[model samples]
Target: MRIAHTCANCGHDLSRLCALIDPVYGLPIVVCPRCREAVVRTSIPVRTRARQARRLVVSLAMLAFSVLLTTGFAGAVIGLSSVVFEQWVRAQRNSAAPWTHEGFVVAAAVWAGLALTAGVWTGAMLAHWRWWLVLPAWVAMLFGLIFFVEVQQVVEFIAQGEEIDVLALATGVVQGHSGTSRVLIASLVPFGLGYAVGLPIGAFTRRSAARRMWRRRRRIRLHRRNA
Candidate 1:
């Protein structure tokens, strides 16, 4: 039997990765220390698609938690601002009555672009620059969030005794959306582009870092030889 001794988190080669006995399962599992915490939190190994699916679930849960946290924070800010400025909430509701779909499209594009950049960067850092691991997971997460919101909207619409405009329900969460097909394209394209760009940029970053490390090591070795 081939012994699978690879990391369950970052897919770092287990040659240098450490091994530990899983207390819960009472089994010896080899994983990198960098991702040891994640492995411990989630006993599912990364060696199989089954485990990857579990990781995706965990990631979805985390994304939901983050969204809740952000929503709460935003709510607090709005509440405080309303209290301080008395007419703040009224002004906000009244001021944006004529927002165009194009404006919303631009906003979505900008938001998605920034989110993708930050998420990919953080994932790369956490996964030790493994773009392969990072990109797929990030894409899954984005899709998961989109799916969750769409489902919620559909549920709410059904509860309201309204016929679900499936297309509009999917993309209507974006403020001022009229559920037009164009709005869907505008909202989705940026996220698609973001996902597309993440891999190449991550690859470039890894290559650049490797080159810099090589040069630094070469300089140190030369100096040592001269000394």
Candidate 2:
């Protein structure tokens, strides 16, 4: 049985690529299309493969945790805002409060700003430049939120002894509430944008600090040697 191999650099499967024998060392090699790294078949040990698998698992776990934290944070913010708005409307004794459109736009803007701040902090803390990873988490959060709201609405409708049309409800949620849906979707854009902006800055700052420490250690060692 032929063993499958993956590129250490980018995790691209080597088995899919055409294998070539190195002329100098007579070793089987494959060039990874994603990162263009030449992976030698024999050079990869079982331990290395296991380590890579562990790293992948850890990365996936981190992403999942990030998504949950972000979703919860966003939910809390929106919930708080809604409560405040309701309280204010109640105080004013206004039946027709301008919360339908204006409230949603304001909430979206606030969420976007909060997301951007959170993304920047996360990027700086992690110091890894894979900004596009935020998009998948954002999409997951959006869908999860939608599913939750739909379920709640369905439950309430049933409680009211209303006939349910799943298709029509979904259509109404997407089209009738287009403004709300658009705001919800658009609010997540800033986080990704902020992460992209922050990652490079964070990485550069980290590298600079590391270089300074290295140079300081090198200088101390040279001075001691001379002494």
Candidate 3:
């Protein structure tokens, strides 16, 4: 399916114009025969540009919503798992049992799973974007949240009249003092990996579905013609 090109000024169909270099501008343009308006090769109609802008805004909104939703879900799962693990530990207090980091492992797994799911959903929803671009943006958004938290901590420390060590602050952020920070750091790789894997899957699935529908429509048209 292709969009029909028309003159921006006079709305004359310019689809059939012979590609020519405009003498005045020395640029490739299609001269609309009816209005004699030269539509530059690089010029997009206002309507098409507006539509693209709307799509971009929608894609960003969807991406943000997905991230927030995933973050909340992951937090809830980790909190519940932690509570359950604490209860189990109390129950086993009578016996001489070794302490296990099972709760941390479970939380990490939950974060990774949620991140992967979010990546897949985002890739599918914004399949028009290049995977390379999408992956970096997605990872940056995750890390950006962590950075914001770190900055807040730094500000709090300053407010308390504590001397700040840049190296220590950086190390702490990297080591993750908070659960949210840890989850974001741990899921960084998984989120990017999932998005890289999902892009091709999503694109292929969308294309195949479109192709099938096109074939079906063609077949129906042929049947009608025969009838």
Candidate 4:
């Protein structure tokens, strides 16, 4: 005895007629050949683009949230550590600086590491974004945050009624652009290195999830076959 399949859209019986069946990728779908052709022609490409755009938006949002969250956490940790270390250093010697410039550099590097790692992982898990995409998103997030902070400061200067020096402003803008470019490269390079390790870890996790789902579906099919 053959199992009957029904059309997904029109609910027409398709078991004895020309039908298209697709069960591998997502939900099992049975439809008339005409409907399948129409879907191929119109809905599929539109849905694909829409899905990609949605995922990209979600990834960017997650990246932003993770940067804010992890940066706050790192800042809190650094603040506490600084206080404790400062006390210890002060007790040890009267001449030692509380936080050295070298120490500040090290702390900044650590914070960057934390921020990038947290952002990439959270965004990938939530958005199902490709691993390669995360690096670009990370770079964009850094530039965006930096731009926003600088732009806000510029606006505040204007609000304070400071005399605007057009030449000075132009020079600052040119210099700022140069500095931002350097910062972007410095930040993105280290973050991209992390991506090498992180990408595989995320891929393995997603692949394992897919395997489990496939196994479950296979079992269901076997059970139905027996029934």
Candidate 5:
């Protein structure tokens, strides 16, 4: 008969994370404040498979919601931004890579949704070393995608009435790609590294804060005893 309290959103250790209520459920549910995905108690007696299934459901839902919000918001923003940069964006379309096209907004939304869903599912199910699966996949996919596009771009540049040599263009793309991959690796590495780096940071912060509160309480007791 033991259940620990937690946030309803992020699954972050609610010992330091804030709690929110599920308005419909009328329960003191915890949730990720930013994404609003539920944070539930995971130490249930359910089988490992059951837990994985549950995580998949929640993660997929989160991804769907993310797509809705991102597309809806981005559409609004793009509409507004179009007034300022539509010409520039349209001008670049011929030279831009296919992935960078304006018309692929829906596809962008779908891809983002898939990535978020996969990442969140991996995070919840593989709370341990499993998080690495998602980050590495994301990094690998990003690079693979960019490499494919760069190759196509060079081909297109050559096909058109352009003076750029295809081989030289490809060589430049490879060099440019090296830098982009490094940036992605750097950005995504933190999430994979978070388990090790985050634990000590979170523990020390929580412990130090608790100690100060304990001292304050003890001082109040001492003052009463003296009086």
Candidate 6:
């Protein structure tokens, strides 16, 4: 019905106990698993600092990879976007149709937000991060790609000053829509696929690092004992 326990580290007395069975360790901490601190069961804040840290590192790495891969593989599109889209935005801002310019700016902002969100989501998903985080990340990645690849194409066309070749550019992207839609769709596949692909890589990397950390810690602990 009841068990006696104390903080493994601090040895604080706990009046009540929880019913948790860590078959490996075989104990519940009055020292809460939350804060990894000794508590009287008052408010053991569930500190996910370690998880969050791992997720953060993975998020950053994924973001880098996502951007690099997307940019590298789709250099033309990305480059065109940088050169074409921004210019269009500026032009729109100055033009009589200023609202169009605002749209362009809004579109760019959306893309940026999506890229970041995607990076973070893919990262966390791979890290086996919480559900609350996973969905948002996926959305961000998808949206980011839509804006980055598609909208960029749109700007390029506006800048080209050439007669629009409906067939030349509209390969896989814009089926019903125009050339830009095609570009967006092209990127969207990988952008979504990235989450799936990025997950395994992220998980693998995180696991590898954690394993190394565990080994190093064990070695040090052993060394201290021998000494």
lDDT of each: 0.48, 0.64, 0.63, 0.54, 0.50, 0.51
* lDDT preference between candidates 3 and 5, better one: 3
Task: Return the TM-score for each candidate structure.
Answer: 0.27, 0.40, 0.40, 0.40, 0.27, 0.29
Q: Give per-residue CA lDDT, model 3, range 1-227, as digits (tens).
A: 12336787898877655455556666556777888876764434686578679979997997789667756644543444344445445546744342345554455566567677767766665678876787666646655655676799899989999999999777777665354444445555766677777777889988997898797566445434433
Please report how far candidate 6 places residue 214 from its true position, in Å: 1.3
Clashes of each: 0, 0, 0, 0, 9, 4
TM-score result, candidate 4: 0.40
Per-residue lDDT of candidate 5, residues 1-227 (tens digit): 22344444444455444334445654434555657666543334455468679879997997888556534433332233232244334546677754566554544344334434444433443344444465665555555555676677767877896787668766776675553334345434333443344445545665786798797566445434433
The TM-score, computed over Cα atoms with residue i paired to residue i, of candidate 5 is: 0.27
Model 4, which residues run further than 4 Å from truth? 1-104, 115-132, 149-181, 219-227
Clashing residue pairs, backbone N/CA/C < 3 A, model 5: 7-30, 8-30, 8-31, 8-39, 9-30, 9-31, 9-32, 9-39, 10-32
Error of 4 at 169 (Å): 10
Give the per-residue lDDT of model 4 (tens digit) for 63-135: 7887677555334333433434444345447554535545544655564576466555544453466657766
User: Over the stretch 93-151, how does candidate 2's per-residue lDDT look in tens digits?
Assistant: 65545554455446545666776775675576556635567566655566567667777
C-alpha lDDT (0 to 100) for residue 109 of candidate 1 = 42
lDDT of 1 at 91: 41
Better of 4 and 5 by TM-score: 4
After superposing candidate 5, which stretches have Cα over 4 Å from the reference?
Answer: 1-133, 161-171, 193-227
Residue 204, candidate 2: alpha-carbon lDDT: 87
The total of clashing pairs for model 2 equals 0
Error of 4 at 189 (Å): 2.2
RMSD of 2: 15.5
lDDT by residue (tens digit), candidate 1, 31-126: 566665333222224444675688799979977876665344333322332232333233455665323334444444444455445454444334
